[model samples]
Target: MIRIGTLNVGSMTGKSREVAEMMNTRRVDILCVQETRWRGNKAKEIGGGWKLLYSGADENSRSGVGIIVNSELKEKVVEVKRSCSRIMKVKLMLSEEVLNVISAYAPQAGCDEEEKSMFWRELDEVLTSISEEERVVLGGDLNGHIGTDRRVISRIHGGLGMGRGTKKAKAS
Candidate 1:
């Protein structure tokens, strides 16, 4: 099976090598990276036989997302979609099936409501656009709160989450 993982790099500058090494050590085939803070929509080879496909805002370096593919699966990449600075997707051909890998960075808790709404709306659009027959692997920093207490949500949460739940988390 293909191993997939997610990471919030904070900023990708000067950290490609470290990221690649971590992936190799963990034996991860695909990694979704967030908060890259890089400006541009492009792909780069970050050594250790890994490739990074990223998308960032042209005017700022605040938000970005990317997907890292190891050498074994790099050649299977068929399409790349840079939805925005906060979202990106890569399609891979695995045998007879298609795998869509999406990397996303949601607005932080301090962000305005409008920005948060837009981020969620855009993410929903991207997710809905894909067909059900295709495989989907979505990973990212969604900026959600599960609270330290798992008594209420034990079925979905594993009791390792930190912090207290906010009104938003309770509403959801």
Candidate 2:
């Protein structure tokens, strides 16, 4: 099985080596990085035989997302799609089936409601477009918290969440 992971790198300009080292150390096959802060859409080989596919707003240093594939799985890449700075997708051609991996960076809790709703709407569109038979994996820094109160959302949460309840949580 492939070992997938996600990280919010904050910025990636001069931290390529550090990120590569972490991937190698963790033995990660596919890594989804958020908040890259890089302003480009391109793929490059960052040492340790890793390939990074990144997308960001043009000429802007704000939101960004990317996916890194190890040398072994690098050749299996089928398609890469970048919808915006907050969302990206990478499809891998596996031996028996295709795997779709989505990397997303959602607006933080402090952001406006419209921004947050838009992020979810975009992400929902992406998720719904994929076929049921294909494997889909989503990873990223989705800012929010599921508190210990599981009775209200037991269907969604497993009752193992940490942190105290927020005003919204208590109200819900």
Candidate 3:
């Protein structure tokens, strides 16, 4: 199985040096990053050993996301779509698996419910448009809580409470 990891960089000053540094230890084959805070060639030049295909964010603030894959791995960028200054998409190919990854940092606040709702609605539509033939792994910071605590979610859905504490072994 290929290795994949996601990290919330929390506003990187330049190329997300701190985030990249921490990620280096995991030796990940593919890394999905959020809150990169930069764009264009500047972002590309950061973090060696990986081909950075990314977009989003503006010149003043780096509030976007990207996909950093080990260059040694033979792959192609199928697409890179930016939803907003905060959300971006990176579609890639790995081995026999077509990996479609999205890195998102959503609106967080009691007053931003409208914004959150709209974003979710649009996202749902975007996801639905994809055919099942394509394998997808969308992940990112997602600052807003989605009703249930995410960590508690199991590989098998609707079976446990949030986190390892609430899980029970599947009956034989």
Candidate 4:
């Protein structure tokens, strides 16, 4: 089985020592990191044995993504997309299978009703493109409390989800 880990590091510069310490202690086969604040000139291979693949913080602090693979592992980047913010594509060479991983950090809020709907609707469309049959995995700080309620309330529990989060999770 593939062991994967995702962490919203909240700006590595804010906690660089903590981030490095955690990574050193964990034996993560594949790691997805967000809010790295990585820069074009400053980002480099860190830690002793990690084969690093990463990108910097984009304008508006939009895209900051990083992936780490065991240096002994054979791998290549399949596709990289910085198009819609921090979503990037990387493919891994497992012993017997090729795995595809997408690292994403989505937009946090919208100004109005139309904008809010449009934002999530776009996320849904993107999710539809992936095939479950492929060895594909998505990891990042989605920033949506869909899987876990922030207020600890569900619609059935008298919350204001309006069943939107539930439907999106089911469909995609």
Question: 8-69, model 2: which lDDT tens digit per residue?
Answer: 99898899999999998889999999999988789989999999999897876568999999
Better of 2 and 3 by lDDT: 2
Q: Could you give candidate 4's per-residue lDDT for residues 1-172 as a string of tens digits?
A: 6667888776656554455556667866667777666664222455655655676744646447776665554244455444243555567656676677766665554334574566456556555665666587888876554333324444323232333433335664
Ranking by lDDT: 1, 2, 3, 4
Among these predictions, the greatest TM-score belongs to 1
lDDT of 3 by residue, 1-172 (tens): 7677887766555645655566577777667777766654223645565666565555765466777777665247777776666566666776687767776666544335577787677667657766688877777776643333334453333322334443457999
**Candidate 1 per-residue lDDT over residues 39-132, each given as its tens digit:** 9999999998999999999987679999999998999999999888999999999998999999999887667889888998999999999999
How does each model score on TM-score?
A: 0.84, 0.83, 0.69, 0.64
Cα deviation in Å at residue 32, candidate 1? 0.3
lDDT of 4: 0.59
Give candidate 3's error at residue 103 in angstroms: 0.9
**Model 1 segments beyond 4 Å from truth?**
147-172
Between 2 and 4, whose lDDT is larger? 2
Off by over 4 Å in 3: 39-43, 59-62, 146-172
Give the worst 10-residue stretch by lDDT in candidate 1. 159-168
When summed lDDT is taken over every stretch of 10 residues in candidate 2, the lowest stretch is: 163-172
Ranking by TM-score: 1, 2, 3, 4
| Candidate achieving higher TM-score, 1 or 3 | 1
